[model samples]
Target: MKVAVFSDVQAVLPALEAVIEHIEAWHPDMVVMAGDLVNRGPDSGGCLALFDAMRREQGWLPVYGNHEVWVLRCGEEAPASEGERDIRRFTDLAWQQVADQAERLHGWPDHLCLHPPDADAWLHVTHGTMAGNRDGITPGRSDESLAGKLPQGVALFVSGHTHRAHQRRTQGMDVVNVGSVGSPFDGDVRGSYGRFTWRGGRWHTELVRFPYDRERAARDFETSGFLDQGGPLARIVYLEWERAELLIAGWRERYQDAVLRGEITLESSVERYLRTIT
Candidate 1:
């Protein structure tokens, strides 16, 4: 059996468009989205529409990501506290672009397992670890660390949250990260995913990378209200798409603590963080 997985396509419609063309050409027996199909970029609503359409026509399985959890959280009743309200106010408009689809998230599965016909080996897939979506599995983690993320009795464990593409083996099972489709943190700016083929009694995995219209994606950031309305942090997100690197990690590393402690406002922190990156 052949399988393909996509993760972290954070609402970049063009990238999502390019990825679908490629995956369909591969003609895998199964197609799965590991999560984050919406949020964090422009066209969240459009991306969700395409994904739902794919599910209807092509049988793509949806696995909810942390971002989906986040948007779903946002769709709930507004926070009462001014502090909490301030936080959501920044990005609320960006998320509200897809408020209609937020209800659909209620039906999404947490994770999925794939079993090839009559085969003992199967694939376990999730947006993140069993611990939660915020927990990440990277290429450089130790066997012990990766082992903790694995679900028992699966030939292959697949996840994508770091937006970094990598694969590692621990305890006789393969741990593969299919990487990011819409936004990649890894230096390589290409769209990425995982291709798995059942051959010779084992799952053969490959990290597939391809270039898409980065220019158009960048323009989407400017035109889609994600940059203007996605909150103070949205600028940095656009920069990541331009740089194909992580800015949010650095921003959070330096100012997140300060913001959490109320030492600085979210707006102030974003200003300070951008000064260094820009």
Candidate 2:
């Protein structure tokens, strides 16, 4: 059996389309969307709609990522303070586009398990580790640290959220991070996915990367009103795509406290941060 998995579409329609086309050509027996199908970029509704159509027409499995949870929380709970409200305006913008499909989004599981026929072990797929959706399993993590993240009785574990693809075997199991379809933080602009083939009583994995129309994706940020309306945080998200590197963590570490404490305006902090980087 062949299985394909992808994650972190983050609302880049062009990248998603390229990955879908590649996966469809491979014609895997089963496909799983690991998670983070929306938010952090423009066109959350577009990405969700296409993924939903694939889920309905084909046998694609869906899982929810931390971004999905954040969008839902933005809908259910009000921001604690004015600073938070301003900081979370990007999520609020995404929520507006997807609020109508809250039931469907809510129904998505946090993780999934697949038992291949005649195989003694099962394959586990989640957006992150067993600890939480935001706590990712990366290549830099030690084997000792991974022991707590891996679930028992699984032959193959699949995940994505760090946006960097890697494969490792330890403690009698194989783990693969499928990477990102839209916003890869590994300095590679190409979209990525995971291809798993089950043969000879074991699973073989490959991390596939393909180029997409990134220029179109960049334009979508402005055209879709995400940059203009999604607040200062949205700009950081855009830079992440442009550079294919992680910036939010650094921005948060440097400016989140000041912004939250009302020491600096969100707009001003973002501008200052950008200057330092550029």
Candidate 3:
């Protein structure tokens, strides 16, 4: 069996387009989107539309990620403070883009289990781990720490959400983080995905990194109205795409409480955070 798995295509249309073209050329037997197919970056609606078409026309499978969950919750949750409202605007924009497809996204499963014909080994896929969709499995974690993250009796565990691709062995399971299709946080700007093959009674995996039109993708941050309407934190998200690294976590750590308390404005906090990065 030949399976292709990818995740974290956070609405960068160019990257997703390029990756899809490549995947079609590879012609895997099954294509699975682990999650985070929307939100962050730009062109969320376009991304959702493209993937939705694929799932319907091409039989592609999907697993919901934390971002999808957050998008759905946006309709039910009210912010406790203005600062939270500011921070949530990004998701709000995404929600507006994807609201028409809420029921479809809600139906997506959180995990996938596959059994290759005539093979003793089975495969599992999820956006993150059993702990939750936001809890990612990454290379920085120790093997012992990852043991609990893997489900038992599966020969291969596939996941994304860290946006850093890696292959590891823990608790007698082969684990793979397929990386990001839109903006990866591993300091590499290329789009990434996993190619898995079942042969010779075992599974072999490859992490494929492919370059796309980064300049065009960058232009989308403004052209798609994401930066203008996605609120104060949208610029930070654009920076993450440009830098291909994480800034939100550190930014929130340093400024969220201050912004919430009205000690510092959201714009001022963002400006201060920008100064810290190159």
Q: How many backbone clashes does candidate 2 have?
A: 0
Candidate 2, residues 1-278, lDDT tens digits: the string is 99999999998999889999999999999999999999998988888888888999997999989999999999999998778998999899999989887676878998899878887678999999999999897779888887677889999999999999999998789999999999999999899999999998889899999999988998899899999999988998999999999988988999899889999999998999999888
By TM-score, is 1 or 3 better?
3
Rate residue 118 of model 1 by lDDT: 74
Query: Would you give me the overall lDDT of model 1?
Result: 0.83
lDDT tens digits by residue: candidate 3, 1-278: 89999999998989889989999999999999999998997877888889989999999999999998888888668887888888899898988888776767868999999979897587999999988898998889888776576788999999999999999888888999999999999999999999999998899999999999998987888887899999889988988888889889999899999999989989999988889885
Please report the candidate that would top TM-score against the real structure.
2
* Candidate 2 Cα lDDT to native: 0.92
The lDDT values for all models are 0.83, 0.92, 0.90
lDDT of 1 by residue, 1-278 (tens): 89999999988888899999999999999999999988878888889888889998888899989888877777776765544555555347646777876665678888899787879797999988888888888777777875566788899989999999999788788889899999898888899999999988789999999888988887888887776676677777778877779788887788766666677888888888788878
How many clashes in each candidate? 0, 0, 0
- Model 3 local distance difference test score: 0.90
Off by over 4 Å in 2: none
Cα error, residue 257 of model 1, in Å, equals 4.2
